[model samples]
Target: MSDVKKIATRDSYGAALVELGKEHDNVVVLDADLAAATKTCVFKKTFPERHIDCGIAEQNMIVAAAGLSTMGLVPFASSFAMFAAGRAFEQVRNSVGYPHLNVKIGATHGGISVGEDGASHQCCEDFALMRSIPGMVVLCPADDVEARAAMKAAYEHEGPVYLRFGRLAIPVFHDEENFHFEIGRGEVLRKGSDVALISTGLMTAEALAAADELAQAGIHARVINLCSIKPLDEELVLKAARECGRIVTCEEHSVIGGLGEAVCAAVAEAGVACRVKRVGVNDEFGHSGPAKEVLAQFGLDAAGIVRAAKSLLG
Candidate 1:
């Protein structure tokens, strides 16, 4: 296999938006005083007329984007995960979610991976917050390439979509051509019978690496990249429960109501009795440090996945 690229998921959103903007004239990009930080500056430079920077007010930016969507234009609003989901949630729920608007929320710096910014900027509860909102499609792309494809899928799919990206420069696991990405479908990266590793966002890469490590230790692990969270692929999750016998779910979000909890709900409702272990932020505040180190400190890294897999097996 060729070497995978190392790119931040936020970069993928910007690059994909540029391509989408070139293909469709009706596609508009909006930013909340974070065009440069959120990487929407590229789109702004490319499509000055279509790109709208709504200053620092994320709530107003969301309403403005929703207004554009009502006008038949596809608007992608960009902001940090914390402010976008927390501050602008009411506007998002009322103006966008209530109307089932086709507005795309591209939230970068998601979860603890924001690093150095501490817990204030770390939106580990974003998945839970957005998923609770009605008619929202929560998307957490695994890598830069997947983030790019997610941008396209979120745009094509009608309704309110929340795309979560991170600041960390993680490994690009999925090849843009080979990995088939649909809005509500889960992609199985590797198949195994011993245990299943269900993950999303940058944690998917960690899951894959942990799977490889487990394989070297004679533990076969299946890796499932769950891109869509809200309209989760229950069929795939049930299959993992029935076949794998045990599961370990990983995500950058909190363990409370994030990917791990979501998977458990699917397995339980399906009446599939399987061992499930979760590795993620455990409802604790994070400290200032590098993204990778902070993740390791909080037990959201590959070592965490490996430990969870072994514990579940035991």
Candidate 2:
């Protein structure tokens, strides 16, 4: 992956906004004084009139987006994940989720990937918070291609959307032209029967690498990229559980209420005879470090996925 073309999903989010802005006159962007960090500044640079800076007020920004949505404008509220999802959870739920507005929350710097930003800035519980909201669509894209495509999809989606993008530049594994993306649909990168490696966001890259390692160890693994978290692709998950009989769920977020928990609920509800293991940040706060080192320290990397898979297989 080091040799592969790397791109941060936040960068993709900003670029996608510019593209959407060009195509739709009703498209507008609002940032909580983090345009540069969240990459929404790129959209601001191109369309200054359409970009609104709420001056570090994440909750106010979310409410404003909700208001703008009523005016027939597609408003994207941009901020750090901690502020957008954690701090503004109340406003998002009451204003956007309650009304089912067509507002998009572009939450960047999600999970432990915030690295040196430390625990306060890292938002590991965003999925749980956002998923709890009725009619809220949660999406965590894997790479640059999917992030841009997700931005387009979020713009088109009728109800509220929460998109969590990463700060770290991860491997650009998917081809832009060849890949196809749909909401509530999981993409299978590799197929095997020994175990299913399920993951979302940047962890999908790690899962792909882990599948290769598992193959070397004679434990063929199936790699499923679950980008849509809330409306999870339960069919693909059930199929994997039925075929592989073992599942390893991974994410950059906490294992409690993210991809892991979603898969567990799906498998349990389907009554599949499968063993599921979760590989992610333990229910703990993150400390300051380089992004890659922090992820490895928390066992959110390829080796961690392989370890969990092997344990489940054994």
Candidate 3:
């Protein structure tokens, strides 16, 4: 795993912005004084005139992005998840989400992956917060390939989009030349019948690894990657529940209202008689520690997914 090519999703977000800027003159980038950390500064290097520094006022920055959208410019307001989705909730909901503006929020450093940034920076509830808004499209990309593709999709889609990225540099598994990403769709990476391992964000890679571990135990777990959280791939989730009869959801977010709840809701509404378990951070705040250690402590890694699947099968 150490030898594998790895790049943080935040870096991918910045690279994608450069590509979008080069292609579309209407594209504009804005940041709440976090151009470097959130990686929006890369776009500023190429299109300095198009980038705006909002100077730490996240709420005001969101409103400005909304205003820019009305002027026919595609604005990507960048910030940390804690500020982008937390501090600017009211403005994002009313200013951007209410009118369904074409404002793409590049929220980086989501979940406990912020590591030593501690509980104050770790936002385990951003998915729930962003998903509550009407007409808001929520997306959490798994890797570099998915993040880049998701950015392009959000730019093309007309509505409020919350693009979640992470600080950790995870594996680049998806082949860029072959991978395809839609606004509201999921793909089954591995086939199985004993159980289904569905996940989003960084956990998608862990789910794939867990499938390998389950195979050794003859459990034959299926792996599902769900980068889109708002307009969930209910059709794919229902199909998994019906076929597998048992499912385990993995995410870097909290189990309360994130990917787990989304899957459970889909199963319940479809009347699927499948048992499900959520592999994610519990209803608790994260502590200051190394990112990998914190993820292991909260059981958000491959071992956690495997443990949840075994529990369901047993």
Candidate 4:
């Protein structure tokens, strides 16, 4: 196998914001005193007047971002996933979502991927929080190309959008021209009949690997790159559930109220029957360690995905 070329979605977000700033003068970026770590430092350096540091107050940052958006400025707020959705949820709900403000919450360091920072810094419940909001849009791009597209799309899209990304470098599966994205659409990566591996974010890559592994074992698996967690592609999900006898959902988020839960709800509502399994972070806190080790320990790695697939097969 070739060496896995990985790129962090946070890096892609930083680059995309800089490009957006250069192309559109009204695009502003705000950070909660984590410009360097969150990769908003590049934006701050490029557009000094447009970048605002809220000094560790994520809640205040959300309010300020909503205020900026209300004034017809496209504000992309930067912070860790936990702080953006976990801490500033009320501000996002009332100030941004309620008013339908065009504020982009560029949440980084999602799920167990923000290893060594421990459980507090790692946000496993962000999707659950954001999806519950009435008017908020929940998005989690699978790779660098998708991340760039999502950033650009969020700027063009109206209403409050929550874009979740990770801190660690992950395998980049999509190229610039290969795949395109829509707000509520999912992409079919591979086609098969026996089973379907549906996933989003960092776990998408792992699901792809698991599919390849299953192929070697004479099992044909279809792979679906499901980036938009909320407002999920119910039609596509149900079709997959009907076509494939077994369904497996992969995400770096928690097993509860995340991609897995979203898919399950869709399947249940659609009256689809299939052997469904979920691969992701369990209901447990994280610990400070290397990213790979943390993923393995938390059963969020490729091996975990393969195990899930095997169980579904049985």
Residue by residue across 254-273, what tens digits does model 3's lDDT show? 99989999999999988999
> How high is the lDDT of residue 195 in model 2?
95
**Clashes per candidate, residues 3 or more apart or on different chains:** 0, 0, 0, 0
Top lDDT model: 3
For model 4, how many clashes? 0
Pairs that clash in candidate 3: none
Please give, for residues 1-314, the per-residue lDDT of candidate 4 as tens digits.
35868899999999999999999999999999888888999989999999999998999999999899878899999999999999998988888888888899999999887988898898999999999998788999988999999998888888889999889888887877766778899988989978889999988888888888899998888999888887799888998999997889998888898999999998888788878898877788888899889988877866787788888887
Tens digit of lDDT per residue, candidate 1, span 91-136? 9889999889999999999998899989899998889889988989
Q: Regarding TM-score, does 2 or 4 come out ahead? A: 2
Q: Report lDDT per candidate.
A: 0.90, 0.93, 0.95, 0.89
Provide C-alpha RMSD values for all models, in order.
1.4, 0.7, 0.7, 1.1
| Residue pairs that clash (backbone atoms under 3 angstroms), model 1 | none
Candidate 1: regions farther than 4 A off = 1-3
Count of clashes in candidate 2: 0
